[model samples]
Target: MEGFQQQFIISVFIILLGYFFKRTKILKESDGQTIARIVFNITLPALVLVTFNQMEITLPLVSLIVIAILFGLVAAAAGFFVFRSADTDLKGMAIMMMPGVNVGLFAFPLVEAIWGREGIQYFGMFDVGNAVIVFGLCFFIASYFANGSSKFYLRETVSPLLRSIPFLTYMFVVALNIFDFHLPTFLLDTAEIISGANMPLSLLLLGLYLNFSFEKSWFPLIGKYLAVKYGTGLVLGLSLFWLFSDYPMLANTVLIGFILPTSTTAVVYAIRYRYNAKIAGTIVNITIILSFLLIWVLASFVAYH
Candidate 1:
């Protein structure tokens, strides 16, 4: 309990530190976008490529995927339950939770650090599941709310994935690992050093970036995001852990990844599709703020052994 509490406190502090620093007079608002791009395009990609690609596929890998997909479905159901009394209902809930997850370093590496290689192993396996359902369904839901037909342009929809150089690099790395295409130790060691550097640098940059936007943004939207997106996903995550405590570590990883705060990139999608960027950004921010509490309760339960 003590360790869990400590970890939770640190997580909350880091998030608040970012929020508060951004509110102070350190940088201009434009710097936030600059920092975000650097994280996404550079450091994050390096981390993903090294970690994700180095892992090999196996039955356990498949199990992780199954777990992620099932978790996604379960979360969707919970979101529906949350909004049952609302006029918009499940659609709103789905848009809030499913599509809003930050799948890259925002989630995967954090799980890795929390649980170790086993922690991130599930990330390599389940990230695909997270990608397809969370982002995919979010797009679908957005289309569902549109005035015309409900179907989306599949090509444009997956264009991001297609152009994801890091993801592509990861695929090759995994293929090599699975095929036993053993590389020199120096190469592996190099990957280890570089991949490991990603998180600290990116987090620092995030800190630097957050130093720019301290002013109040959108509290109401943040509140709604907390209630539906994070609130529903987190509750479902905790419930799943309580039930599957036998596989505590795996359960913990998947649930946290799902229950994690909305990715800021979701705001880009919201703006691109005209789905409500203000709402999505607030959801992302509040989710980041609240997830530490939910994750702590869950890790305390699941990692208790």
Candidate 2:
């Protein structure tokens, strides 16, 4: 318990330090883009490769991929129903925001801190499904609404997934595991070294991206969005946790994964599709703050219990 608490404190402090740096002009918010690129393209992929290399492929573990996809689908459906009366642009924004969780940037660092490789392995599989939703499904929703066209562009939908480094890394490592093939020791050692940076970099990037400014008018919409997202998350997440209580780690993973913040990609899609980027950024930021607090509470409960 002491160890967990200490690690959590350190993680929060690193995040604050990143925010502090940003405030002091030591690192601008724009620097977050470069940091994000490094984290996603380099550190994160290294961590995934190293973690998944050690993980054994199992029927139950693979099922997490399906669970993540289904969870995203359910959330997307809820968003559609809840925002049925909104304007086309807002509806598109809401739908795209609903489906994906910020597992890579937000959850991975904390999960690594608390549960180490074991936790990563679980979220790793969950992330595979999440990547599909983020790169494929969410993008499709944004594009569909943006163009207001009946046509579904298969190439555009599929291209992002193919180009994503982390997604490709997940597929590569999982395939290697399935084939019972191991990377040479030297490669694994190099990957392990690079993977060490993932946690700190990710936490710091979170801090760099933090912003509190938003139009006051967006408050009601943001509130409703949060209620819908987290409300659905709590209902489904807790129910699944109850069912999987026999497997404590798996249950915790599902609970945590379900409630994670809206993906940073939500803002990206908003910018791409010309859907009120300021409001989208505001929504994502708030979710990060709320999810961080919620995860801390959950961690405290887990520790004491």
Candidate 3:
């Protein structure tokens, strides 16, 4: 319990340190992009490789993948219904933001801090399904609404996932795990060294991207979007917790996974699809703040209990 509290404090402090760097002009917010790239292409993949190298594939782990996909689908459906009366642009933005969770960048640091390698293994499996939703389903919805066309392009949807190094790492490691194969010791050692940097770098990158600016005019829409996103998450996450209470780690992972901030891809998709990027950014920022607080409170409560 003390260890968890200490790590959590360190994580929060590191984030604030990054924010401090940004505010003090020591590191520009845009620099986060470069860090993000490094984290995604290098540190993150390294972490994935090391953590999942020897992980055993089981029904529950596989179930997490399925659950993540289903959860996104449900959230997307809820967004569609909730924003049915809104304009195409607003509707598209809402729906796009709904399905994906920022597990990689947002959840990894805290999860690593709290549960160490064990937590990473669980969320790692869950992220496999999240990657599908983020790259596959979210992209399709963004494109569909952006062009107002029903056309589906296979390459367009799969291209992003294919290009994702971390996602590829997940696939590579999972395949190896299934065949009961292990990478060379030297390779694992190198990956372990690189993976050590993922947690701090991710937290710092998040701090750099944190922004509190948003138009007051969009408050109502943001409110509606958050309400639907988190409201659905709470209901589904808690229910999953109840069902999976026998597996505390899986249950906690699911609960935290559901409440994670809107994926950063939301803003990227909004920009690509010509939706309102500012609104998307604002919603994501707010979610980051909200999720940080909620996770802290919830984790602390669970720790004490």
Candidate 4:
């Protein structure tokens, strides 16, 4: 308990530190992209290699990947039905933003701080399925609504997954592990050095990009997002917890996985699709704050050994 509390505090403090840097203009908003590149292309990939290289692929872990994909689809469907009456312009943004978890950049730092390598490995596997929603379905939805007549192309949507450094690293490392191939000591040592920076760099990047603005127009949309996202998460997460009380790790994964904030890709889609950027940005910022609090409460339960 004490360890969990300490790590949580450190996590919050680091996030605040990044916010301070951005608010004080020590770093510009555009600089966030540079930091993200470092985290994703370098530190994160290294972390993936270091962790997945040793973990064996198991049936449960494979199930987690499938659950993540199914959960994403369900969440998106729920959002669409819940807000079916919303204006056509706003409906697309709402549905696109509702489903996916920010499993990588947002959840990884906290998971690593609490449960170390195994936790990361679990979430990394879960993210493979979620990636489809983030890079594919959500993108397609946004584009569809943005241009009224856009068609879904598997190649176009899946391109982001193919280009993702961390995703490729995950696949490479997992393949090597399954084949019982050994990574060279020198390579693993180098990766450990780089991967050590992953958490702080990711948290710092999150802080840099955090933005919130109050708008009367956005409140209802934000409210609906909270109710749909967290509300659905709470019911499903708790049910999973009770169902698999003996398997604390898997149960907790289900809980935290659903509680994770909306994918940042939602905002990207909003902007690219020419949807209501203000509402999109507002929901993203607000949900992030709420998710931090919710995850903290959850960490108290799941972070224990």
Candidate 5:
């Protein structure tokens, strides 16, 4: 817990520094965009390549993936019903946006910081299902609503998944691990070097892209979305905490996983589908802030315990 507190405090400082730079115009929004692209295209893949290759797959790791996916499906179903009264676009968008966790950019860095490679393994495995929802289900929902058609093609749904560099790296590493083949040491070292940039750049990218501007009309819906997103996470996280009290690693993983902010990937979906990207962007920003506070509180409780 002391380790978590110290690391988290440093992490928050870096994030706030990013926000400060953007606010002061020391770094433009375009700079943030460029940094984000580098993260997604380069650094993140390196991190995934390094970590996924190194993880020792086990039943518990597999279970974490299963639980994450199940939680997402349940959340999506609930979101559909909750937003049933909205118009088709808003309804579909809300449903798609509400469920998936942001493990890559948000969870990984913090987990790696607090719990090191062990925590990364837990969350990375959990992201197997998360990638499914983010690159598959969420994309389809947004596309369906944007086009005003329910027609779903298997190719359309999966193309983005296959196209993702990090996704491909994950699959490649999984296959290698399963077959008992290891990456060359030189290659692994290169990946480690690149991945070292992932955490700071990612947090700074979040700050650079942070936006507070939104239509006043979006307020109520955003409020409801946050409640469903964080509230559901709270209930599920607390239950897992109690159930896995003896298993600190699993318990803490579940708790932190629940509080991770909305995926920046959602904004990508919003843009591609010509949906309300602004609202999606706003949610991303807000959730990051909310997740920090929530995680801090959770960490405090853990320390006291």
Candidate 6:
């Protein structure tokens, strides 16, 4: 636990430091989503594809990680319903729990920095598993909100890659890597530049979104969403950590996984489908704050034992 406490203290500092930078104008206000788009569409896909192509794997943990994320996503959805606090207005809240990582910004570098490339390899291993589940289920949520409202359209299968730029971006990268294609140096360099801008910029964009809230009429019910975000994240993540502790690979696994909340990926998708974009942003903002403490606790646990 000593290792957990020390690393947790440090991790919490970093997380809060981000919040401070956001509040103090150090992060500025403009260019949040543009950077997010760049990272999602360009930077992340490149880093992931390059890394996946480049890394040597002795263990095929990608499937395992995917299973784990799917389990978590299911549980998160269950929490949203069983807790039954916010279902009446679930239109805005469901997107927050979309399956994915804080990859690129939080998990990608954080895992690499903490556990090195091996960690990222494992992270990549699990990404597709989470992606399929999250994106697929997100539509279900969208359809729920569409609710005979004439806004919902159900696809018989996965939509075209063009339908999902972020997913396609990584899917494209992964395909190129698996096929052993070499990218032009100029393209690689461009990816590095855009991805480099994802973190600080995303944080500030978060700050701007966090500034908005439901109208005064909606404040009381906001707690239901807050409850789902923090409560499910902490309880589910920690529970998984404890259950998996006997497995050696559990080393750095949970910390590496929950680095950030459900990403704005859901928000972007929700907006495209017209479910409730602002609600998605609110969940992202609030979840990011809750995660500061939860991830620190989880990270400390991993760092130590």
lDDT of 3 by residue, 98-204 (tens): 99999999999899888888889899999999999999899999998889998999998889989999898899999999999999999999999999999999999
lDDT value, residue 184 of candidate 5: 95
> Each prediction's Cα RMSD?
4.1, 1.1, 1.0, 1.5, 1.9, 4.9
Residue runs of model 2 more than 4 Å from their true location after superposition: none
- Error in Å for residue 94 of model 5: 1.0
**Candidate 1 per-residue lDDT over residues 1-305, each given as its tens digit:** 56546544554455456556666755545666776665666665556555555465666566766776676666666655654565453245334455445656466545655665666666666676666665566556555654345667788558766676555555666777878776567766676676665555444444443322333554543454457666666666667656766766656765787677665655665676666555555455555546656666666665555
TM-scores, all models, native as reference:
0.77, 0.97, 0.98, 0.96, 0.93, 0.70
* Model 3 misplaced regions, further than 4 Å: none
Model 5 segments beyond 4 Å from truth? 303-305
What are the clashing pairs of model 5?
none
What digit string (tens of lDDT, one per residue) describes model 6 on residues 101-183? 45545556445545654666666656555566555565555556545343434462277334756556556655665677778
Q: For model 5, where is the 10-residue window of minimal lDDT? A: 203-212
lDDT of 4 by residue, 1-305 (tens): 88889988998888889999999999887899999889889999988888887687887678788888888888888988998898877888988887788888899999998778988988998888888878987887787777886788889887899998878887888889888998999999999999999999988887887886577867777788789999988898889877878877777788899889888878778888788777777787787889999999877766453
Instruction: Write one digit per residue (lDDT tens) for candidate 5, span 35-67.
Output: 877887899889888887756778777878778
Quality of model 3 by C-alpha lDDT: 0.91
Question: How does candidate 5 fare on TM-score?
Answer: 0.93
Stretch of 10 with least lDDT, candidate 6: 148-157
lDDT for model 2, please: 0.91
